[model samples]
Target chain A: MDGGGSAATIDHLFRRQHGRMVAVLTRIFGMHNLKLAEDVVQDAFCRASEIWKVDGLPENPPAWLMAAAKNRALDAIRRERTARNFAPELDRLLRSEWTVAPTVNEHFGANAIRDDLLRMMFSCCAPAISEESQVALILNILCGFGVDEVAGAFVSGHAAVEKRIARAKKILAASGMLFEVNSASEFATRLPAVQRALYLLFNEGYHGACAETAMRTELCREAIRLIREVLAHPNGAAPASFALAALMCLNAARIPSRKDHSGNLQPLSDQDRSQWDRDLIAEGLRLLEHSASGTELSQYHVEAAIAAAHANAPSTEATDWRQVVSLYDMLMQIQPSPVVALNRAIAVGQSEGPERGLMALDAIGGSERLARYPFYAAARADFELRLGHRDAARAHFGDALAAARNPDEKRYLAQRLAACGDVSAPLQR
Target chain B: MAEFAYLYRGGQRPSSPEQSQQIMQKWVAWMKELGEKGHMVDRGQPLEQSGKLVKAGNRSVTDGPFAEAKDVVGGFTLIRAKDIAEAAELAKGCPILERGGDVEVRPIMQMNM
Candidate 1:
């Protein structure tokens, strides 16, 4: 048997089980005991790693983990009954010897675990928490990402990320309840925030300046998984959720071509179209169509529409730039940000000539907001190069290279800078 | 080739899911390498931390095997090698060493009955 396959299975088993066990234990132990819940889950994995080394692997690893975690939960409850309180709702029941086992057993059921996971997701993204903290909590608590991984994703330090998660958890515990997932009105009110958090999560993964391709994909996959969970529930089937799902799927479909064989960043113009995943593109299109049933027009809808436009095109030049420009206009109306305006200006560049693209960039009032944005300089450089303004193009490319976040981006800009003197160089297609 | 026992001693616990995963992969890969080299005899089971130890003089059983946390034998595996040196050399590849654990390699006495 191939060892690689088994290795992947074991890796997946541990990470996936970490999330599952934490969610279940949190449900039984209460939000205040979040750290305790994590400790219990961590202990279970530690045991598995020690034991499984000798035994190879159990017949059903998930089942084995589930059983192990259940016993640990029971042990924790019995040992701390006097010293600690559980989910306020279950406090009395968990304290008594008569009901503690059954109470723990009831929550550990497969169905309960599923609900608990969703509850955990919603709680992590609760509106009271800051957006950064929400993202950190989702990674740490819901996705079982370590502090270091969260730090890596944010491009921040370990201590900062740790503080953010701790603060978010404190706010969560003070609320003293898992967001009631079954309440329709509350779900409606909070669904948008949850959707936003997931969208941010996907964007962080897709457009991450971080160098680790493996981690980028993991974050993207986790976002997609949680989004699907949101859509699976009856109350979570919002039009915006469908649009968000489509947006993620379509973008994720292009992940394979995001980097070249040497692991350098590949801009959309340079990426080979054939490398895009057809299945994911198809699924994204289907979801986009489904999202159209409702009249609500979310930024995700317009964004997904833009992605669908690109997905359907045979090439970047063949893509309907006018249609893309219109979608961006819609996106601006729904969500006006400097980044959106910058992208809109670039789309205008594609549809119009180099002169018009330059004018559009200049017309974007408060353009200084994009001064630190590397892509803004890069876009200007592209327009300048296409217009045969070699001196201007060279300067802008230098600016872009200086502003670029990662080595891959810097290399791409450096290459573009080198081409400014090549009068024979063709305009970027 | 002679049968030898690999007595795995205490190691540090993995702090993160990803780290635990990497450690597990290292182990599985190590064993696969041994198996392919025809050195793996029997992959053993881990001994539970809690167990009974029978006292020799009193002929009484009590909850024991309470070795120092770092010295306790956590698990064992049986393998075939040319000799103790070869077995010890092969044991060097065990993942536990990365976590500060050690492996005691000893040959099983052969009976000529």
Candidate 2:
């Protein structure tokens, strides 16, 4: 047992290593043997927990686990052969004994395992799966999320989420999809899908679906980490990935200020700028600059720029609503979503006038997708409040509160309702 | 230090045969890269979804490879290492990690023959 190694040091080792081991093994064996491979891997981890409990931790815990898994896999293969019913193809694989020699730099080399993991990420988030499933799968496999955690991300129940994952895996196996990162051209084509996955992940964190504690922070941080990893890789890094990283960082900078001392939600207007993380803000700005190096602006780039403007502001009043509106305009042109248009209308209300913002919001008949979205109601409430329509504002605020999932968000809406002279607050109940 | 097997799991949703071909090609390329780097030792055969597990004194025979939808084991690779750390480091480069699958690392117990 290595004295230097501690459980805290390898906190998520079992979870994170789970994905990496699966990927490397799958690469060696074909996808058909996935079930056996996973069992071997899990057995290895279980053994580690048992051994480490008595013998103390290994110096390189991850490597120790990997080695155990390999031995078990070899044993399983041999056992299968003795049954004489072993597949001829597997028999061939068992016959070839390849050994990995250890070099000082070989372990934890930057390109060694990280590259495989990234490739795996790209493959899992392939455009083949629907965006919803992609996020769900990534959260479960890559992030080690349980079914309940994933279910919380959607409005659906646990069973529905389970079925979705089961259905996804069935499709993947039936389709015989091999796990590999797309080529440069293919990556370019699939960039949107990857970006969407990251975006959805960030949103899950931002919207506070997973949990109330630092889980949101973890999700946001991981989303940025993944996007950064993509951008850092020569072949994997696309401008959009960088933009997404920048956007996430910018949003993340305000995370500390998002919640008050009592853990109540603080709207942008009330959040203390001093609480924002300047270092993260700087990183966000730098990445945003790198993302804008190209002539064409992606929606992610525009969104990041908008977020950057907010981060740079010392107060809500200092936010460059004009620039934000302009970027939103560009974003609408590139990827016109009702959500984007709705957000753009908010910027217009701030930069141009409430009347123009109202007109813009009214032009787009509320899409069904926006029906359950709390932000739509919140934005409507804000617009109506500014236009002196107190009654309308109160009603919209109530709608926003009903749609709100997070306790903090519900509190924020309740406060807003109170301000609108609605003495009766349902939240108090 | 130890031997490790990185396991890949989970199945792809249905797709066109052409897409399946493309995925296979990628898998081959990835394996080739690992082989070239000398990180690959014994590669396990890709097993079909069906298999029987015999366990306990009764040697109970159950439906083979029966697991929850997402918990299936797909494939594995056996790599020798100085220790578990080295094996884990090698497992990091596996492509299956991206597909919501996991890599399990373990040490091989030397059998006295």
Candidate 3:
């Protein structure tokens, strides 16, 4: 038959299908056979591409693909005499006729497949690796992100990002970690690391420095979807997960407002509050409230609370800096990072005085991580500007402008430099 | 039953003779397993990465297998199955996955032009 049938689907059908099939197969084959499971899924997509050019698209494309993938997996198993060496248990499991069915639901129940995907996420984001590596691996395997997309997220080279992912996968494989959704207590222990990974993924998407616009949106949406999945499951849902979701929602509500009509980045102060997604804002607020109901407050709970306050404000002038500062203080107690302190310093500058903010910033000392961060320079410039130190503000703004990767950010820094009014002579390096 | 061919893509990078022999040993072990299960249609063998792709229009022939190592079609396997689904079910157990390689499972077209 002509393979024209499957060619009509959306572009990412293969990639998305690849993830689902891998999750389902991994559930059946066990995590140690992840490579085999992923290969089977990839092969199914390759077959679809070839046959769909002639046979036309299937009536139920996903089901057709799943059935094809399952069959390929089974055939490969039957052919391998040494499968006993690698996966004896999986070989036994495959011998049973129930796993490889013609129908998708018959092979992998719908709910079971979804649970497997969630389990894959938890396993990929285990606390064994650095948070940076965890997010990169999740984006690669779960989201089907390319090396370049992940590299853009980290503001680093593609090779560096690829190495990070390869290393993370090796670590996971070596640890003999299995893909299984954890119980409430187990999830609770790992929840913080998972939350951090999700937040980093969201930030990467929201920043929009990546190559494909849709990819960034997908990352944001997927993070939200996974967080919601966690919240829906009885054992998976936790206050921390809810708070992380709320924070993402609050931040995402501003996505449409962040960029202007010309697609330029609009600073929070310059954004039109009316452009924000009110439904999302309301949802974020409700989640924040639920998160706060618990006695133990997490960094996410405080961050979401702070984001909620910003969303509720009608204008930058209307923002309750005192409340934001207090939340920042609470966050600092929970997670002591120079980045958090820098953010709190900005809040302090607005609430109290630039002098107080400067003192807080200075007390933190030099942080190597933030040394290259443009936001740190921007914050210093803002504090300097508020203190009427025009020369110092101009120099710091120049530093920020040089370091800013996004064009809109560079423009904003230039504008800030102009506002400093040190135009008499060009500022020296 | 329909015969399916699995294209195994590996050895994109030049390897030592020793490494190539090791790979072949693994392939032989794999083939033995498939043969015993009665899944083997014929004795499948690997082919060198030197071939031409003829385009439909003008029937233009491209240079010998010019593509990225990852994109190159490496080798193939012929297996017997009840249907396309059955063929795909068999392709899953291939060892290519361990080496970060891919398999292309396709039903052998019955009719010739």
Candidate 4:
């Protein structure tokens, strides 16, 4: 076996198998024994690590893991049957030697594992838990993230993340309903919460107020991967889900150019348009079109439209700011926030003028709410600078610099401030 | 070249999926590196934490290699090296050491039957 090849395959298999094995085991063990299911999956991975390190990867890595997990499941059932209850539904079936292998095998079947994963996703996204906890649970259980990775994603402490996941798991297990996919109406109501959690997951990665670009990308990729799971199920293929997928894909397409090789923040204007992933953009556009069939206008639809507009533009100057402004208007109506208003005001600056943009920003009802947001001040500074109000630009840039949390963002703002000081420099558009 | 044994000891189970995957990847990569460097002899198996420990007199057999106890011999590997010093140096690259486990490097004595 080629060492490098086997190592890379094991890494991929670990990521792809970890959540799946857990989900399948959870289906067998019930939500109450989620921890036990996780333990079994962990055991399988540990066994694989030890064996595969020497034996090299099996011809069918996933099948190998499934076999390992199945054996572990059988062992767990046999050991604990007398002392504990398994999944309420399968407890009886699991207790009998005759049915045990078949029962575990049934759940571990390919189709069963996919459905179980969907159920696990919905369970993690249950509305009973807070959104933050929901995202953390999804990362931990569905994306196979460790507590440390979850903490890294959220820029939180290990203890806090651990507690959050535990509390959320308790709530989910206690809910006694792992979100059965039987009813369309119930599924419809629950889908929004799931979508929201996934959106937040993607945003945390893309915006990444936290450092560690690699981890941030991992979050985004996981979000995309899990969303595809939701989209794969017949009931999950709603317009909003399509829109959500579109929004994620379009925004993700720009991730390559979002930062320079040295990791400095690259503003949309300065980003290398050619570096944008065209394939993702195309897929996003197709999803956007699919999303248009439904009459319901979701925040995702509006947001994805804004992203599509950016994706279509050859450069910042070529972008249809008017269309972007209109989309922002729709987004504001759907999901009004200071962030939306701030974005709208920036678009207003581009489509209308710096003067109009300032007026729009001032007219925002909760303008004070955005006082701490670095981009709020940065947008104002951009408008001020473009209008040749160097003094005002300098002040706003200074404010942005003070508020910016990310070092790259802070450096960008500082550079903008310094540029404001150089009066002889040609006015940047 | 002489055969060397790398005895892995005292690493806890990984607490999370990410950590589990990382440990596995590291071990695989390290083993591969060793193989590429012409040091690999045989990839060894991980020992079960619970096993029969027989007394010399066969008067008692106990279950353990207790996992909870510190410094439990967990797993091992075999490698080819020039000497004890080279074997120990090669053993330093084992992934278990990253988790604060020790690798007991001992030469497999050549025997004539």
- Per prediction, fnat is 0.53, 0.00, 0.00, 0.66
Tens digit of lDDT per residue, candidate 4, span A283-339? Answer: 999999999986989999999999999999998889999999999988888899999
* C-alpha lDDT of residue A97 in model 3: 61
Instruction: Provide a comma-separated list of chain B TM-scores, one per candidate.
Output: 0.91, 0.73, 0.71, 0.88
Worst-scoring 10-residue span by lDDT in model 4 chain A? A3-12
Per-residue lDDT tens digits for candidate 4, residues B16-91, read 7667767777787788889889988888787776788777785698887645555788777889998999888877
* Cα lDDT tens digits for candidate 3, A351-393: 8888988887777756667767777888888888777678788
Better of 2 and 3 by lDDT: 3
Each model's TM-score, in the order given? Answer: 0.92, 0.71, 0.72, 0.96
Error of 4 at A12 (Å): 4.4
DockQ of 3: 0.03
Worst 10 residues of 2 chain A by lDDT: A99-108
DockQ for each of the predicted structures, in order?
0.47, 0.02, 0.03, 0.64
lDDT of 2 by residue, A213-241 (tens): 57788678768867876776676566777
- Candidate 4, residue A409: Cα displacement in angstroms equals 1.8
| TM-score of model 2 (CA atoms) | 0.71
lDDT of 1 by residue, A63-181 (tens): 98899899988999888989988888899999888998898889988878887888888888887898878888888877878888899998899999888888898998887878778
Model 1 B-chain TM: 0.91
Best-performing candidate as measured by lDDT: 1
With a 3 Å backbone cut-off (N, CA, C), the pairs that clash in candidate 1 are none
Interface RMS deviation of candidate 4 = 1.9
Q: What is the clash count of model 3?
A: 29
Candidate 4 regions with alpha-carbon error over 4 angstroms: A9-12, B66-68
